[model samples]
Target: MTDHRYVCSSCGKTHEGLPTDWGFKLPDEVFDLSYLDKYRRTRSNTDLCSLDESRFFIRGLLSIPFTHREGEFAWGVWAEVSKATHDFYLENYSNEMAQGTKASGVLANTIPGFPEITGQALDIAFQNSKSRPFFSFPRSAEHELAADQRDGIGHNRHHQFLELCGHFDESEA
Candidate 1:
């Protein structure tokens, strides 16, 4: 991969590499709670979270291809799943045989520039134990993100995402 460098617009510090991946630290629902309520109602690790003994969430990659690049960019986002689905994932998390397991979920993070996607239906596909699950919009969905996933995005859009994530200033481009 090519290493790109920039001064962060948000932090004003030099950062190396073109950031190809961005992630949400927590699901929006859990994050919106008051400090005490958040601690009392949510249990979370880096990969999984449960809120109020009911809502279950899993972190996964929502990948978007680069129209002219060799690989893809990804957002490490969260998805809300049914208790049964979350339990199944926990059960098979360490098993390679769980590859190809599928479940349905709702997007739990509001993606930058795609705020409408937060509650959209998603199709989650489990890969091998070495990888996080992959989240995708339904093929028939009309959201712009679905279209981006299907058609890929150009460099301009990719740069826009970087700016949106506070990685760099567009004026510096």
Candidate 2:
């Protein structure tokens, strides 16, 4: 299998590598709890692995993609950023994010090429939400138009995360 790597443009830090084909093209949303749990554990310690202020930022980074927007807030893209990028965003945007300032400001500030990066993620997320990955919509019609766009954003997020880790896997999305 080929190896994959994801680099953080902000700090130029590289995250863990993975088998290029390990998860890509497998299947999205397999709900691999064991894998997630293991990753969670590994990720928790990452904060301490970098800048002192970055610990909480790492957790927040992970939260970006894992958590879905409930009402007016959702940022599940951070989990995928290179550790350095993760820390950068947290360090810069923690205050804004906490205060609920320009929503994507944190990302725009921390992640390099964040404008396009976020836009890409937006496409996949819109598609995923329309598919109702975790929950079913009350009506198909209500979510009909935004389905592909939403999921498309989610797809981009997955791809970006994989890219950050230097891994190119998409099956787990």
Each prediction's number of clashing residue pairs: 0, 33
After TM-score superposition, what is the CA distance of residue 77 in candidate 1 from its true location, in Å? 0.5
Model 2 earns a TM-score of 0.22
Model 1, TM vs. native? 0.88
Supply candidate 1's per-residue lDDT for 150: 89
- Model 2 over residues 93-137: C-alpha lDDT tens digits? 334323321121112112322333321221111111112112111
Candidate 1 on 49-145: residue-level lDDT in tens?
Answer: 9999999999999999999787888989999999998898888999998899899999999988888888999999998878999999999899998
**Cand. 2 Cα-lDDT:** 0.29
Best candidate, TM-score-wise?
A: 1
Number of the predicted model whose lDDT against the real structure is largest: 1
Per-model CA lDDT versus the true structure: 0.88, 0.29
Find the 10 residues in a row with the least total lDDT in model 1: 1-10
